[model samples]
Target: MLKTVSGTGLDNLWDDAKASGMTESDKLLYRSNLLGSDKRVTNYGGGNTSAKVMETDPLTGAEVEVLWVKGSGGDIGTIDKSGFATLYMEKLEALKGLYRGPEHEDEMVGYLPHCTYDLNPRAASIDTPLHAYVPKKHVDHVHPDAIIAIAASTNSKELTQKIFGDEIGWLPWKKPGYELGLWLEDFCRKNPEAKGVVLESHGLFTWADDAKECYELTLDTINRAIAWFEEQTEGVAPFGGAAHPTLPEAERRRVAAALMPAIRGMISEDSHKVGHFDDQDAVLDFVGATDMPRLAALGTSCPDHFLRTKIRPLVVDFDPANPDIDGTLDRLRGMIEDYRADYAAYYERCKHDDSPAMRDPNAVVYLVPGVGMITFAKDKATARISGEFYVNAINVMRGSDAVSEYQGLPEQEAFDIEYWLLEEAKLQRMPKPKSLAGRIAIVTGGAGGIGMATAERYLSEGACAVLADIDAEALGKAKEALVQRYGRDMVRSVEMNVTSEEAVAAAYADMAVEFGGVDIVVSNAGIASSAKVEDTTLELWNKNMSILSTGYFLVAREAFRVLKAQGIGGSMVFVASKNGLAASPGASAYCTAKASEIHLARCLALEGAPEGIRVNVVNPDAVLRGSKIWTGEWLDQRAATYGTDKEGLEEMYRDRSLLKRSVLPEDIAEACYFFAADTSAKSTGNILNVDAGNVQAFTR
Candidate 1:
């Protein structure tokens, strides 16, 4: 229940760090603060931190640089420059290819050279590969108690959806190291604009050009997550009742010593242990009375802590005669087996490959009936942090009834992540796609109108365009135009009736095979009808609804399906007329259909937001120059109805807006580009007006 620390002193710290110069002491202090922040967020040794330094190379006797990351076995808060394991970036990327091969997991086991000093004695963090993957100057990864408390709950995905929208990407839990690095590498390539990433059941990561920005973003991200959780649950409540009466200091020491070895084995670290407990009398009484199994199950919030603490711990009831040592050990081992079996089943259902799983569980908490709780870590600092995360999660769950029931990615998906060939290929092959390159974009009704304009804009922005239209010939001509500008390989023409579900599904299946997946969809296939309310036939109304309302849903649904399958962030844009906001004479069918599209955008925006798929609507006024709806006959009929000459009628429509001008198709195209780019990363369900300042009678 502890909120994030304030940012009041952060700017001052940045300035001080910048002005003080990089003295040995200053560097050590900065590293300490970085590590401390990470541990506070995640469990003991459950997170990683790194700093980049520019030092001359000893081998070549030239000015070569290297990244010095946190070495294995060192606590973040206590580590010095000597504690870092340095690696050349070129060498690290080279390792990706060797590590990705199926046999490399088992074959590549020898220690790789890190830095010049203590090369044989120290090892790098397991997350080194990921740190290498990012091009940022600095990186920090942590499993904040507040975030994990939320991520561990069954409602995590839904709650995250409601909170961060489609901007934040969520990946199912996977063991850290090479495989996890590859998964993240692929994600970063796909979402080049993302601020950070949340690893479900794992932790969070934030990186930037500088250390200060990275740190502040981390705090802000976690605080936003906490705020979202609070908003959903109304408020957070305190955890279980008070602690049990205290025990002798010697007895506590003895218990901690017994647990230390197991923790050391998990983390492969040799360190000291420390213990603390709630002083509340109520908490003491409750812990003393609660069931041993329930209390122990609440151990560490994430799995990486396993290296610092074992899977489960011993619970002693303070028996004198029958100390129950053998029984307690047997029970603890049994629970570990149960946890492993459950974990294995989850992996089987979620993993896509046959990679070996981690040998240890993240952490364990021992409940000593009346002697209070005993927590263990590879280091005292880690143990303390782990205890805090567990206690906070326990409280939140008890208060929210938000028990941890993970919904892992399906087996194939997990396999894809654990043994991602695509990510490995990216490191070795051609340069990564320009931020938006190779991304498939579908624009409905993309033939000689607003749709064509948006398609052209997407091409200029580097996305491969797939233009769809009911008119096969027009779609073909539009494809030729796009190909002339962006080359034939970057554009495709598809004839589709968006109103037909079968047609939409078939097109998407073909498009998925052709483009790998669809990343951006502009649902702009709409028809306008001009008829008086009394003269509007039922058939005409249904036809308008079919193409405008039903057509939009079909395209969006299919787009979401494809994006979710690809496990990538996607964007969708719905085109609604200004008349949808205000009634117009002789256009009931068109107005109602457009209004439906607007409402549909809001609903889909909320539903798709969690999956990193953004949905937005653009309301455009009359722009009929290139449209069939603005034919000479149509204009003459409208002019007669309005009792004005054709020129006067056009002037009236243009003058109705505050800008006193007509909105071009290019104007709407620009709005679509904004919604499609990184600039609108946090926007969804927003109604952007492309109208020349026309006031609506009623606003949503």
Candidate 2:
């Protein structure tokens, strides 16, 4: 039943191909989308598609045959022509004659760029040559969980014969390179009737002259594997189960909500690195199975999975009722160390003198029974992507074991693929991530307005954004909104009263658990108050000072403590106000507290400079839209002071500024980003005004 996504109907597939105004690259995009749409076929960036098309070269203005293959930047489902890595097929083929063996492997990288007919910035996929070697005009190479389920099993040879018979050729594990191309080239010559080549412990390479047939070959092969799995496992429990039973869904989430942050803390090696906990059904089922420890030890679903997931998942046991967090966390730390030691031993066993230095011996995933599995990496982006890839692996391994024993590739084979030059080329093609890519940042009062904007900016620039506020309801709503846009991994929410030292400590501890450490802290939480000095009551004055002045001090103190503990220098931005630089009448409480907060930033900056922590302040005024302080009675009161209605006052305030523009939360966010990112590496003890050019509050 597995098939292409609903697009380009089969009956008209050739009709459209024959009578299409769409460019070849556009047609390939359409086909790639169809292939990538089904998660069963390819999830995330797991596949490559290509078309042999003739195009006028931009450089030489001559028509040339190029293989336009989907490269980096997206999964098959969402790729555009821009995702296609256009290469001259003739030039790509010319290098095939020069290959003697695997020695020319690394040199393939140097040759790819020169062979690229178009100077597209995106590098060709590591499997470019595999596409080039085949005689077909179109190719669909994807890792369908169903196909991998068969190919990754101990009985792979038997299953391969059962499913495809003489129609599909089989190759033992070979890392994608010049070597793989040679193997495929020779096999195609001998097995001319084959529809595809099943790469053992790898994936599928299916091709046809037409795009539709190539896609059908991939789907049809996977369907055959699925059919075999269905017929063989008629009465068998999904996989060997003791771990199959699960805690109540609610209880499981409760355990994850508590345990994941702690696990994240235990495994994190640096302030920039973080953890992502995934409790999807497949992950939970696999981790909860009784024989999970033994089954998981088999290894990654494939060699390429090792690039992100490492060789094997680290398994742990947990009691949902007595999740003895602190003790359990300590145990996790020891387990991670053991995992590292074991990896080093494995490296010692297989390592050659010329091998690249082993990647850090750390667990990318932890299979916990009650809490599901948690994936760790340097940043939220990597953590989530790795998380998805691991989920696919879990399904493949489970299906493989159900069919036969799960026989993973040897550890040395994984090492070869892990250190292959093509993966190095992929790494080389990766653009430098943003300065805050790995930093964990928290914005206090980030439920809405300037704080929320600042949190969003941090997430976009690759920092983990934790929204901290005193309002739990608001925090929950904000978390939902962010997760809808950025995913659950990059954003977190915690409720805290910044003025209460106990609350502040608890908040900081929560941060420690979630991200191992905190690097950038935005002290944005504050309460706005307006009254003449004589008219303000003692309680009102205390309240304003507690939130604006004392709150800033507490958050800054905790940030310093957390950063010092981690031994990683960080950045802190205090969201002061224009009133801090110039006082306003009938607003003594708000003005004075803000003034104190600015000075607090300067003092912190002076203290933090020696340790490389930068502290800066942004004076944001009249950012009335989306602000909790600017609504209802407060809005009426502020507008009354200007003798105008709310809308009139907004315009009046905007018109009065030197630039005659209203300050927005995003404007303040831009300044906060400057301080939070390394853009201000040399800047500290600084103040940037975000009040639309208010000269009266300008500071030298």
Candidate 3:
């Protein structure tokens, strides 16, 4: 049977979250408790809560500040201050102006680059803007069990109307982020006095002038709906009291970790914020009993909760002595494949656009005979919530049907919600391309390490790339490597200097003709000139900028023209250096050129917003393999200049960053691919620090 907490306990959490004396962490925990009070309330990292703090502007002497939102992948229950991503209200509002409608989202996001690099690379929640849109000091978004149950029902609209009345506005489920924010903005503006908004097939959103009010409102609203549900089905009894065997704790954790990534991808977030739950008694009882398959088929309480607890649970027969673990695993894999096939078929039937499909299942519940229940989430909070909801839903469903049976939103409806304009807006805002198939891309300095690695990365991801370098022999070698891997038809070789516009233009035109048109460009060519500011000369300055800055401009201009003419948006990646932000004693020109490239990316992002072209820069530090920059001789020389051994120099660099390690070419390539792929479609104008952790000069 589903468990219910006292109304007073839920109310207390609201008061606690609103109290001023509590630390930020305490407030977050308090908010989480309030959000998690009901079984249908929240699952793992499926929900978020925020409190806005007003601070005095040091410059203006007026109270103006930022909204400290839950960082990307943060679970509402356990998130602390460190889990919150701060955004200047003004800047967030400014982002709103970038897109006028759904069509322009790709262009707008392409122009507004990621502002800083100090925070985690995991993106801020798509609902960041929505929380900001709420005029209240506190805001929350959750995949409440009751709410999802209500939404998924065929009579959802009618039931919601009967329960919440006209005060609750409804928006069709849309992808999160800018698109959802825009929709919510419009909804709020139109409704003017709505208490909350419920997204069909999605979840719930509530806000209040204070944290307490928001929490209380959420509780009251959900409870009222529950009351109505009880009235409608008064005779229904809780089901499934049969027990199942349990698994070892260590084994369970291992399986759970392996399962999280798939779940996280399903929910469109990282698994780091997921909560975990493992109760051997519950698992054993649930899985060991008869009709385990029937119990596992009920859908999640909410769509967001899918990541923590997959659409269905897994029932395993436990036998420690004659353990058929391998056989069991194989069966599980087969089941997963069946689930995916079904999901794909549903998507095909419901999809409106050509958006790529998601292959990961959101959550998985484990049922071991004689064991309690074991639930996995990216974090502890998520896991706990999943367990709570699972226990409740199983009880409810089993009672209703003798065997638990639940229905999901129609495949078409689910697909529509999953691919809603608002959600797509968030996705579109990513600073990458939607598809690189049949697109032409050029990699400057392509004969060298980072450049060659990036070129290969692009090829692997399905783009026809041309490798250009000043050295014909090296270009040929690089071309051979790529051709050997992807075939000659996919790669081209050219000898050119990035600094020369004629060379850049000719290469771009030739490649465009060969591949039909240019769509992606990576400005990865440049030389490092190390000299102190006092020892730097105009010649040194000009030499560095000529290749790094001017080369990028030439390539960008050519790409812009092609993309504009094609009337399709494209992406440009400029490879900058960690020195662009941090200071090093004897590298004036290198630093200056890299910094210039960063600014150039910003300017290009803004300029290309209207043309459906996006420009961004990747600042990488200590990239080792396939780069001339991290060569042993090069490191030795740099180490000598710093009056230290090569090992010492490496250590110094590594120790400077939070994640103390050398950045790999593949790492930069991954970041580059992120910008170049459809995943970052809405993002433009952002600068990604592919460095392991070095530059810590600014905070935003």
Top of the candidates by TM-score: 2
Q: Residue by residue across 182-234, what tens digits does model 3's lDDT show?
A: 78878877887888888765678887766667777887776776566556555
Cα lDDT for residue 664, model 3?
A: 77
Return model 3's CA RMSD, one decimal. Answer: 20.2
Off by over 4 Å in 1: 1-20, 23-32, 35-39, 52-54, 61-65, 100-103, 106-111, 114-121, 230-295, 298-301, 314-364, 369-371, 375-700
lDDT against the true structure, per candidate, is: 0.62, 0.79, 0.64
TM-score of 2: 0.80
- In order of listing, the candidates' clash counts read 19, 4, 65
Residue 561's lDDT in candidate 3: 65
Ranking by TM-score: 2, 3, 1
Candidate 2: residue 54 lDDT (0-100): 88
**Would you give me the overall lDDT of model 1?**
0.62
Which 10-residue window of candidate 2 scores lowest in summed lDDT? 4-13
Candidate 3 local distance difference test against the native:
0.64
Clashing residue pairs, backbone N/CA/C < 3 A, model 2: 242-290, 243-288, 243-289, 243-290
CA RMSD for every model?
25.5, 5.6, 20.2
Q: After superposition, which runs of candidate 3 have C-alpha atoms over 4 Å from their true positions?
A: 1-11, 14-40, 58-62, 103-123, 238-298, 311-363, 366-700
